[model samples]
Target: MADGSDPEYVAYVHGRAAALRRTAYLLCGDTHQADDLVQETITKLYARWPRIGRVDNLDAYVHSILVRAFLDEKRRGWWKVRLGVPPERPAPPHPGVEERAMLRAALTRVPPRQQAVLVLRFLCDQPVADVARALGCSEGTVKSQTAHGLAALRRILGNPLEIGMAR
Candidate 1:
């Protein structure tokens, strides 16, 4: 740190960059945009790195930065431009890929706060308390957002259980 850069920050970012990028992708559903989010998060983290030692959970702190960056971008609405149709990615050969793709698409339609809650609690398998801490909200709020988010997803995707019950 005395030499002008914190080695811990460098190592931390190097180790977690890919995971953060993946989380960003989940938040935005665009690879290029996800990269931008990660870059924004890393830049913010570097600025605050000197105080990292006092933090309780470093990963959660960094994740909070990434999510906030994503939410900020969504609020600005500058990335809505269509530079022509997006290129189609070759579908993965997994059996549930279609379902996952559908879910991802629906997720983008959900409100940002709810989407963040769902991604953190279910996708990342973080505890309710951890998610609350990362989002800077109460656990009750996280739980409520998650329920609303899931309901939105179910409505968007058409609940399979309801369909089966009707049959």
Candidate 2:
């Protein structure tokens, strides 16, 4: 901390920084965003540091903080706001750009956690274990979120996107 955060918190964060960054990168898929996630997580840990002595597994507690920080960021969508003109997003790969556009719109409508799981699992093509690790949740949760995300996406898409269609 610039003003001197908790010494124990600083030490723990310094020691485990790389591991935390890897986990954050897995969650958000960007180095800059991962850095932000870690900063946020550490700030949160400092707030609870005095009472954190009772925590049985400190690593797990730190991870939980990181996950919540990531989830909260997603929910708040603060990053969507920018000071300057936003950079244009690259075109999606699908031949039917309109379909992909609609899908993107639908994705925005999904619950934040479900949307995160879907993006990491499908768009990022991450394995269940990796997604689980990134989210600090169980593989079961990843699978269920995937299922629920797909259902929500399909429902939003309506007749344009359907099940049992060949590619």
Top-scoring candidate (TM-score): 1
Candidate 2 lDDT tens digits, 27-136? 66568999999999888878887788777767767776787787887786633533275534567675566555555556666777887788777655778886687677
Q: TM-score of each candidate?
A: 0.76, 0.55
lDDT of 1 at 20: 95
| Candidate 2 runs further than 4 Å off | 1-7, 76-110, 115-142, 150-167
lDDT of 1 at 75: 64
Model 1 scores a C-alpha lDDT of 0.78
Candidate 1 per-residue lDDT, tens place, 1-167, comes to 22225787788889999999888887777899999999999999888877777777788888889988877777635324323657345676874676566667667777788888888787778899988987889999999999998898788778663421326
User: RMSD to native for every prediction?
Assistant: 4.9, 7.3
lDDT of 2 at 77: 69
TM-score of 2: 0.55
Q: For model 2, what is the C-alpha lDDT against the true structure?
A: 0.74
Candidate with the greatest lDDT versus the true structure: 1
Clash tally, candidates in order: 0, 0
